[model samples]
Target: MSTSFAAESALASPADGTARTVIRSAADVSQLVNRGAAVGSDARIVIAIALGGVFLDAYDLGALAFGVKDIAREFSLTPAATGFVASAITFGAIIGAFLGGYLTDKIGRYRVFMADMFFFVVAAIACGLAPNAWVLGGARFVMGLGVGIDLPVAMAFLAEFSRLNGRGNKAARIAMWCPTWYAAISVSYLLVLALYALLPASHSSWLWRLTLGFGALPALVIIAIRSRYISESPVWAANQGDLRGAAQILKRSYGMDVEVDAAALRDTKAPVHKATWSNYGALLRGVYLRRTVLATVIAVASSFAYNAVAFGLPVIISSFLAQSMLTTILASLALNLCFAFVGGLIAVRAVPKVGAWKLTVLGYAFQLAALIGLAVVGRPAGGAQVALAIGFLAVFLLGQGFGPGSHSMTFASLSYPTSLRGVGVGFNQTLMRASSTVSLFLFPVLSAALGTKVFWIIAFAPLAGLVALLAIRWEPSGYDVDAEDFDAAKRT
Candidate 1:
């Protein structure tokens, strides 16, 4: 099978040129990565490195959840200012997602990968050393840039590198982002707990600083090893007419030895893709329009609900259980790691089996149920309140981890061609981050005003998502990249 597959992709020459080379299309690249022998060690390491960036993104974003209260206290922030501090990164993320998507497509994935890490390093340092709310918010916004930029490139690499068959394909690879995100969230909680326990009262101010600053360490590690381990996406390079460069990377990265014809390269007939502002409208037209809408709906809905609940979990739990700061931190850690992390793992496994549509629907259902439960239970006093609050919150996080939480990015990443994948994801993420920014900013205000009724209000986000998912039913799993309308448009 291996020999036949390789022979099928062996060297060839076109009518226009005499040179012979492997006649690899975007489809062939998909097959080779998905079903070929190259899907072993290199694939795993590449997935790890790319997903490692995901881990850091999650860590940096979530680290603030536990630290928000401490920051409010230390900086003497008003409620509105506290919301701004909590949501500052999200505001920056909106900008990052828009610009990063364009830059990723215009420049290249490798360059973006190398460049975005420093955003984390510098921003994390600034956040740790910030002396005022304004400075802290500014630093968080910068960190958001790193978080926002890394996602499109990382997801693109994962999809491009993965095969379409067997256990871990495109959907699976993208779904891994969820668990890695939860893992990072879990790590942040563990770090906060350890710091909270270790730090004396005199030096307790260092908890949030250390928690926020610690995110940089992983980014630095990713930077150190990324250049050595990661390779440029061959599909992307090939699409750009760099047959030799693509061939070299293929040979080196996946250990595939294939001949190349410099003369037979770059289909002159294939349309050149020069991205412009007008292209954003293309996502709203034809088949891409449907996908773009579905992805946006899911991403935005998920971001809205998750940010409102997950980022504010610490505060919500404290209020619900009427617990001290220490108790709240410990409880948040336990629930995040136990429920959210578990749900993420379930999602990773379920993605290949349940399919994106069913899994996402189930996830939304879980979230809906959890929200109702919270609203019904309201604020109770005593151990029953503790039990019910944890139970409902666990269900909410679990539903999220399994459903829209992970697949939002998965849908965005896989729904477009290499030419548009970055932008597609960027656009989806931009809207999603914008939604996140709004939700995070509003959650505190709403919670204060409406109390537990906030859960009922937030539940509507998932309901909307569920309706969109059931209506669209766009399953991106095992989708053929070459078949995207964008590619079809390019030829015509």
Candidate 2:
């Protein structure tokens, strides 16, 4: 062996030398990992790569929403055909999320993140060149799969990497993704508007193609940067009997040069046993059971409700602008600018101090009020009421931006142990994406059937969520996030 390899091997924690696994039916996570939780440059590099994936997630998803109209015109789509094309990706996401979550738990995080990027690049290309509505729909579905798979992986990376760095401010980092998502949506909107201005009406198809093609750019950049910045999860590596690989990745990818305290790195205190299925069962028997349930609920609720609005934003705006095309376009653009960009940034700052749960409750409350106002104002009240309804809709969307709107995933992912971290997060992410699928179908039907009054009724969802939050106290604000699943790791 080379001198560097030998040296790294010597420094690796012996306890982590063997893969320490927690089987779904086992209770072995009694204590392990986390002798040192200080921030490493390698962890930061991982963060950079993960963030890149998320940026693409934001960009691709946002691009489609903004490009839908141009695509409709390009393909001469019927309303139903357009809706099918638009919602295709969400359906793909539901499948990708479930499979990704399962694979992430089984295969590991870095592998999945790397694989998903390829999906983004190839799928974006397909979408841009799609010859017909069916083909475009197929491409979008593939793109959705990429987005769905990436979400949990991104969350898992953030959680584990931040834990190593001893930063409980992980929520702050994840919450920032919300605004980045908004920024992505806004960029696509602006890009399409610019394309509209630059291109003649005869070649409008080019505009949509260009916008769709642009989605691939972030993923490509991310893949290249990732070679230098991405590292395997130290916690995950350690659990998988790759201590030396973990350290090497840490040094090279994150540029971490500090000497690892060997004695501290391998805790003699952590329980060790042959891995078994019962380790996972232990998660459900006690304190973990409640946590699992709470996080799952939040995940499901957030995915359903948030996407119901976000993915539906343009369509909703399109409906509102029925007669006046120009006004419709301008108003929709303004809403995105305010809600996705400005409002989301404000939310990022608010999360750390206000706490994710508090913001969630506050966000839900704002949405409820806004929904009621929208319903009442939208009644037989005519154009004046319609104006008020539009105004209130923006307010409600901003409220969504603040709480259950974007940062819900942050809370769910950060609430578990390193051993169960992948699975807990995977399950939550699966459900979250699944909820989005349900909402994608339900939102249009709900809006069309009940009209604006549908919102007032839907507002009750948050009230239920609010009660769950209060009853469960699934808060992650002050928790020593690193030490959380340490116990679970030992038993495993």
Candidate 3:
């Protein structure tokens, strides 16, 4: 678990003394990346654009949070219909993650990354223009598809483009998705607030449409600049026996001017694992099984609790305080920015030092305590009680930001090597989205039936996460997982 930025001798020119750095195999490219990017390289820009995709996923997923009630009222819907509309996007994400994961590995990260942005544009427009419940639900499901597909590719870009461990290591970059996600959620809240204030009293219902539609703006921005800044992962290219293509990408993106070693090129072997349906099964077998199980549990638990509380924050706040829409909006925005967002930033800095495991455990503990306090307090009746209730909510979110929120992706993305990275994230997200669908669809029904007692049920999620972490004791931060790809190649 050491951190360094020096390139290995494997990337040095051969004894014959050629001017260019020589790449003999995929391992050479991986070693170069593990050593860290060259100063002022375009690699950082590629990571930023990849993070833009994560921003879109968060924006679209949370955009509907405040709007769910309006959607239910406009469609004159029952509870079940409202749930369907609310949960449709997650359902779409479930399917999209499964396919997107395989496709990211089967094709290349660049192709998958470029394609999902269009899904956001088309689906956002469709949701805004929908005339009926069915159309709105359908549009959301399509948007969910984009959200689902984007994560696997985005995580892959962050991990592959980053060094193994250091200031901007793989774990830290992957954990960045956490803050970017909260930042997107905060932006959505700000949009909702702006629309709430600006719209005429008679036209206030238009607030939801405008908020949801604004999602396309960032997607379009990413699309326009993608070709200039983004390129296929050099390590992935070398893994595919394309040393020449890999060398070109290294020069363009990594600022490393290297050449394919002619003698080594002649002896290059095929990649150990080709993209195929059977790779999904590989997740459940041998060494991967334990890591896969641990990552899946972490993701499912995190998604279930987060989707229930974060997505339903407005409703929960309004219920506890019985406040006006304006008050609820301001309160939600403040709690997220002050607690959750800041917590994510802390996790990003702390992971490379304390590691993902200890922080996640601490986070789950905070959430567990917060949930129990909320259940015990029920709906606040007095000033002191109300303050306590809000404090509990803040504690829960703070825990989320630093713990599972930041590191769930850490566990999911870093547990496997480049060869299996796509499928690894895909499988984790697929199950995670399923948990989200269940939570989103059931929250209204359960809250209505059980009221504040619902916190008791929600508490189980973090509890399960704690149990899994304790059982596995696996830490992903600062680990050199990409070496697995090269090691498997050597074995074959």
RMSD of each: 4.2, 6.9, 3.0
Rank the candidate models, highest lDDT first: 3, 1, 2
Error of 3 at 72 (Å): 2.7
Candidate 1 achieves a global lDDT of 0.81
The candidate with the higher TM-score, 1 or 2, is: 1
Q: Write the per-residue lDDT of candidate 1 for residues 1-492, one digit (tens) a residue.
A: 111222263443465454332633444444455564353446578778999889988999988876776889998899889878887888888888888888777878889988999999999999999999999999999999988898989998888877775578788889999989988888988888898889998998899999999988988998888867788887777667665677777677777765654434645764345556666677777778888989999998999999899888888887877768778878887888788778888877878777888889999999999999988888866787768878999999999988898799888988787778888888998999989878877887899899988889999999999999988989988766544522465322
Which ten-residue region of model 1 has the weakest summed lDDT?
1-10
* 1-492 per-residue lDDT for model 2 (tens digits): 011111222333355554222211011111112222334545566666787777787777767665677778878999889988987877777778767766666667888999999999999999888999999899989998998888878887876655322333567667766766777766777787788788887887697789888888888888887776676665566555444555555456444432333543465543322223344465465667777777766667666656666576666666665655455556777886786566566766766677778888787777777767766765534667667767877877687777875567766666665556655565666667667667777887888888866666566666666777888876775454545443444223
Query: How accurate locally is residue 422 in candidate 2, as Cα lDDT from 0 to 100?
Result: 57
Give the clashing pairs for model 3: none
Which one is best on lDDT? 3
Give me the runs in candidate 2 sitting further than 4 Å from their true place.
1-45, 66-83, 163-168, 253-285, 318-326, 379-387, 481-484, 489-492
TM-score of each: 0.92, 0.81, 0.95
lDDT values of the candidates? 0.81, 0.66, 0.89
Give Cα distance to truth, residue 74, candidate 1, Å: 3.2
